[model samples]
Target: MEDSKKIIIVGAGLCGSLLALRLVQRGFKVELFEKRPDMRRKELDAGRSINLALSSRGLWALDRVGLKDRVLETCIPMKGRLVHPIDGDAFLSPYSGRADDHINSVSRPGLNALLLDVAELNDDIQIRFECSVQKVNLEQARVEGFDHKNNCSFSSQGAIVIGTDGAGSVVRRTLMARTPELLFNYSQDFLRHGYKELSILPDSNGGFKIAKNALHIWPRGHFMIIALPNLDASFTLTMFHPYESEIGFNNLKTKEQLKAFFEKYYADLLPYIPHYQEEYFSNPVGNLGTIKCYPWQAYGKCLIMGDASHAIVPFYGQGMNASFEDVREFDELMDVHGDDWDKLFTSFQDKRHKNTNAIADLAIDNFYEMRDRVDDIDFKEKRKLEMHLEQNYKEYYSKYSMVTFRPELPYEKAMILGRKQDEILLNMVRDKSQVVNVDRVLTKIKELHENMRNEI
Candidate 1:
């Protein structure tokens, strides 16, 4: 590896660290920069996304780095959702018909620290924390920034620059600034709903307060609260609510209002999270938004990936998984277009843009389903029918299964076929009065898939 063949990555988060390791494995030198103090040296935010859902796509990326088994040792397996209704006992809805197909809850800081540790051990990788990137010359792969630690300015030009800097990326901003030449297109849609962090402490025995392996949900019509298990036996609870309504974040400003609202909607969950009132008032509310942009690559010398290019709502739990998949895909492309930075950047953008867009839309659609339809009669029936199909037929996968468990399938294709299958299944369950035939449903789906493939 030489300076002339170096790659500059702006953002030493999960995506950037993973990308640096993969690039170094392929014999390219890397210079990694981050705007914040290194978390391994200092403490991280206490109330931020402490844990994330890790599924097949993210696992595939981790396996490529030979860290999958090590990471899995730290995760808590979540088999399904335990739905708690307003007036009835709780019930479980399996994520998939297959027993082994499930997601894992892993701590965000734990995983990032591992990634940074491995990246630092590589001889060809150099990491610069506490450096803020101010400007980028896209065509020349140059970066100018301030070093917060040393109080100095520096600039460097590498062979290529990749932005894994997240939703408000400075590298992406440079692309926006040269919009006329790049013909860049961008759109951001913010949800009326926002989220605040809450928590459920472990029992006196230092065990879980509820079922340890399931994600629990309390889905009220307009808003909801969900919990994910942590390695410490406690659970991280998140309240997703609107901005200004009766039970919204703004209106429930006092302890009395919050306690009453919980009594009305989330009564069963209140006992487990006795400290909710304190956490709710102290934690900050975070926005839920989607950011989509075009021309991810400008002049083939600079490119944006991960949340920097396609930031999505978190309802689908695919935000981190999707970014991990980006590293996997980009690493594979180096084999096809070796040493041609322009061709490699072009292929990466063309391959990922549509699939990321599909996941973005799917995540948004899931927000409504999680809030309003998970406990509905028809939606329940639809899920039951889907489970039957998956159990009896190995080839069948629900939309959630396609997105979560099938790493070989592109998300755009999964979205298209899954949407069609959902429509047919819902119609059959609603419009018919007889027992559903699993064989007939499978046959119909295969026939329709063949027709769609031929048309494409």
Candidate 2:
């Protein structure tokens, strides 16, 4: 096929690669650039997110590129969250009441490599590695960057330039440079807490030491550790804790302090991770933050998507899924606008800005919920009622389900409706005198949703 228009996509990560593949499929020549070496040819660095939860939103995007089934083949189904309380035995909490609803645990690099492979299959898509984007000419749709391997600078122009370069995107920086003209709005809020990746090695018999088909969480009052299974029967554990408290990352510097802390808090998990001390000291503590910005498009010639525009905390496990959804949404916009870059870019940003912002806020809300409230009695009661509602009524959807499973619902709508439902459910569960009637709860929720719909 002959290509008349070209798209310059910055960053060949999950979002960029998927976008490149879809654009090439749509008959536009795609030039995809990545700063790092080709991951397919090199081992990825440790300490980054090695695995991710692949849910409905992400799978919808994969399906658009004909890679859904292949990707699913590489994932392990995580049916629910296994919550381990400090004072009680571990228990499972299903993600959804519907039997078929569950998330998948897939390696981050594995999925990226698969998308890169699919992107490379298209003759119209050109992927360059070790090429760092230095600047973007917003008006001209031109990108200037240094080619590390070639030891020189390079420049390219496209009909439209899309930035998927992640949170520290140079494309986004270019927009910030012209902030006054674009009326750009930007804010980055970091959490006092940070995370470090640890691992639970596969057992001697090559079997999982913990529940294989669940996301395991050990939630403390102010800190927590969560693990997701890998296809190799291993689990990648992340410690989400503060950096300055008495039991924080700053104070647990010595091997003795680490061991003693684990013995006191994560005693059960301590036996599973034998080299906890070594791993703790070797790994880097990554900061958590949410990045939000406006005017994702500049002069309708350049646009930013994924983490480049809205980077959120990883508490809700929706970061990658949200990025993938960006691609799917952008593709939908293209279906209407075709190669009219100006209209397409403008509409895409306008439609997506609020949705991304909604998810960003929801993710932050989930940070506290995951680390502090997951094991609380009131929270547990609310969840139990939510599960019952979901099981009994086909129309009932929890906030988690709406965000995770309902791809048709926008994040903004989900957040608005789900928050109302949460308040009502929590109130009913809190009242000991009220006999929680399923029918009554369902009717009230439906009425609340209708009122919200009318107000909107």
Clashes found in each candidate (C-alpha, N, C closer than 3 A): 0, 0
Per-residue lDDT tens digits of candidate 1, residues 195-268? 98888888999999899999888999889999999988888888899998898888998898888988888888
lDDT of 1 at 289: 96
Query: What residue pairs clash in candidate 1, if any at all?
Result: none
Q: Estimate the TM-score of every prediction.
A: 0.97, 0.97
The segments of candidate 2 whose C-alpha lies over 4 angstroms from its true place after superposition are 1-4, 47-49, 433-435, 453-456
Computed on alpha carbons, the lDDT of every model, listed in order, comes to 0.90, 0.90
Candidate 2 per-residue C-alpha lDDT over 250-278 given as tens digits, one digit per residue, 9 for 90 to 100: 99988888888898889889889998888
Model 1 lDDT-worst window of ten: 447-456
Which stretches of model 1 miss by more than 4 angstroms? Answer: 47-49, 432-440, 453-456
lDDT of 1: 0.90
